[model samples]
Target: MAFDEGLLGQEAILSLFEAARWAASASNGQPWRFVWSQRDGSELHKRLVACLKPGNDVWAPKAPLLILTVTRTTRERDGAPHPWALYDLGLAMGNLTAQASSMGLLVHNMAGFFPEKAKELFSLPADHEPVTMVAVGRLGDPEGLPEKLRARELAERTRKPLSEIFLGQSP
Candidate 1:
């Protein structure tokens, strides 16, 4: 997603995280956490940008906010590995996306980042796994993106039809 340099208010960012906090998780063991940085040219922002891969670095820096998503690998209650941690994190992200859309904002989630670097930068514990990074802001001109990315951004959105996706018998 394209994004302008407009700053998102603290309240708005807090609301986004609140939405994420309400996401359902296995046995109510909410394992998702986030490290966030605003595009104010601060040291935190610079370190966050450095975690991005080359391609993401080109566009993500223009967004007003960036967030690194992480999940606790073990269950807090028993110290066992949480099998559904990744799935739970996905649900939380879905909530975040829905909330953002309602607020007239766009979110671009990227896997193109150095997770190891993020872990080191954030000093994350061994049980926490870095999952993805998100860029958040209002929509901006696609012209700001590289020529190839602009083409992709302007291309028609496509998804698999229900008929193809549904393998079971029709209800």
Candidate 2:
């Protein structure tokens, strides 16, 4: 799932999962979970794709896969509270994004998806909360995006200097 393989095909989906399997978790609880959909005759894909905010809708249409990542409130191996479950999920997503990038596929993590609607739509277990949605696809020409989004398309192109992010001092 390289960055170029935007919205993964069948093979890339398998690879992404393989990469996610190695994500570090709190006490090895492995609370991170995913419900995936490919824009291949999946009824859920219709609603899921429609759920993206207007800005995302423009570029999301190019994605081949949509993933909903969830976190479990309880540990799988023990009954302890999964305090770092969300953080663990983040780590998994990070790995997924990097893997996708390495594979030449593009991965977009979107927060604007309808989380509440997703919960009811997927019928997720009571303890599992759908936290975020990710769009997997190959990077397309930015020209295809709406004018408004085009300007911000590469907004995150550069990371802020480390000095501004962390300095052992208050802002």
Candidate 3:
């Protein structure tokens, strides 16, 4: 998505992370982690932006904020595998998304990144796995996007029907 690209303040960014931190997790382990950068062309920002793949790199770099999301794959206290780690991470992301929406910020999560590269670049711990990258900012004119993307963004939004999505459980 196109972004207005207005820089987000530290307080606003912290609020987003705070919301995510409060999300419900398995046994309240709270394993989600976020690393962020503002679009100020700093070294860290460039490195984080470079973690994105081509299609994502196109629009995400233009967004005012970039965040790298991660989860602890093992129990912090015991170092055992945490089976629900990813699910907890998703919950945290959902909270972050809700908080961002309330703040008039847009968030787009991306799977098109090199997680290993992210780990290597950021020196993430072995169990702290990279999950997704996020682009955040206010909405921008679709015209700011390339022709094909602009057309797509301008098109009517669609989703599967409720009936298709909420199937009745078989007895």
Candidate 4:
């Protein structure tokens, strides 16, 4: 049960990626790569569809699109292993998610995907590290969600208090 759902048009999708392309990275090492899939009937699509966890499988189909994010750690710029590559990729993803939200599209980041299955399904290289999957769709009716999700739909999903998360001098 998302807050809202309005799928982006092709032009909007391009714009969203264009915005993501500019996110700042550690040492300017842009390590993010995205592979997008729509709910089209195809062998690859079916394989990816099968990789989702059962809980996600329920509402994910209602999403307009899916993005498989990966990070490239060893770049010519760094040459050494970039432990922060994944973090940098997250930053870019944050940018993408925010931009999509601003555009009236809802994004659900799912961690329930099977990475091994994703690697095989997408034919990823040995060096390419697959991260999470993102589901973007028009926000459907929460009431339409299954009983479990509906029960949790309006549950107080709260962020940790700043006092707990921040460990610095009080401003």
Candidate 5:
């Protein structure tokens, strides 16, 4: 869906992040971290926007909020390779988006970003890796989107069947 330039209240945003914090994680690692910026046009926001790729930057930058999703690549306790960190982060993001939906907000996740640049720009720890970004805001009229995007947003949404996605036989 397209998004309006609607701003979200601090309490509402906090609720979404808090919901993500409670998601189940491998070894209770809770390895997800978010570097978020609002549409107030701060320098930080501009810097974050530069991290997005061309096609994504076209629309994502207009959302009310942008979040750089990072995951700990190694276990925090002993620095061992945390193979499940990315999966754990996905769980957290699931919680966040669910909470946003419940509050009548929208979230759009994208992989089109330069993670290396994001790391360098933010001075994040080497163990923490950026993988995805999310745009959050209130739903808006499809007509508000750029022509190409409007068509894509209004197109019928489709997904692979569970039978096609899963490995084993159907239950």
Candidate 6:
């Protein structure tokens, strides 16, 4: 998704996180965590943008906010593997995106980042795994993107039909 350069206030950012915090998790483990940086031309912002792959860097730097999602790999109480940690993080991100949309903001989640770099940059513990990086801001003009990306942006959005996604036998 494309984003404008407009800055989001602290309150708005916190509200988005608040929405994410309410997402469902396995056994209420609540293993999802986020580290975010807003674009103000600061060193932190630049570092966050630098974590993105070159393809993402081409566009994501223009976003006003960047968030890194991390999930706890094990349960806190028992120290067992949390198989659903990634799924729970997905739920939280869904909440975040919905909240952002409600506030007339756009969110683009990208996997095109160096997770190892993120770990180094954020000083994440051994039990935490970086999952995704989200770019957030207001919608921007597609014309600002490269021709290929602009074309892709204008392309029709599609999703797999139930027939393709479901496992039940066809009638």
Best by TM-score: 1
Mark the regions of model 4 whose C-alpha exceeds 4 Å error after superposition: 2-7
Residue pairs with backbone atoms closer than 3 Å in model 4 (clashes)? 4-139, 5-138, 5-139, 6-138
Candidate closest to the true structure, highest lDDT: 1
Residue clash pairs of candidate 3 = none
TM-score of each: 0.96, 0.86, 0.94, 0.89, 0.95, 0.96
Tell me which of candidates 2 and 5 scores higher on lDDT: 5
Give per-residue lDDT, candidate 5, residue 44: 85
Model 5 lDDT at residue 154:
84
Give the poorly placed runs of model 2, Cα more than 4 Å off. Answer: 1-7, 154-156, 169-171
lDDT of 5 by residue, 1-171 (tens): 477878887788899999999999998999999999888889889989999998998888888889999998999899999999999999999999999999898999999999999999999998999989899999888887788988999889999988788786656
Residues 77-168 of candidate 1 have per-residue lDDT tens digits of 99999999999999999999999999999999999999999999999999999999999999999987889889989999999988888777
Indicate the TM-score of model 4.
0.89
Clashes of each: 0, 17, 0, 4, 0, 0
Answer with 2 or 4, whichever has the higher TM-score.
4
Which run of 10 residues does model 2 get worst, by summed lDDT? 1-10
Which of the two, 3 or 5, has more TM-score? 5
lDDT for each residue of candidate 4 in 73-131, tens digit (9 for 90 to 100):
77747478888888889888888888988887777888988888888878887767889
What is residue 112's positional error in candidate 3, in angstroms? Answer: 0.8
lDDT digits (tens) for residues 19-82 of candidate 2: 9878988787778888888877678788777667676776665578888888898887766777
Clashes counted in candidate 6 amount to: 0
Give the clashing pairs for model 1. Answer: none
* Better by TM-score, candidate 3 or 2: 3
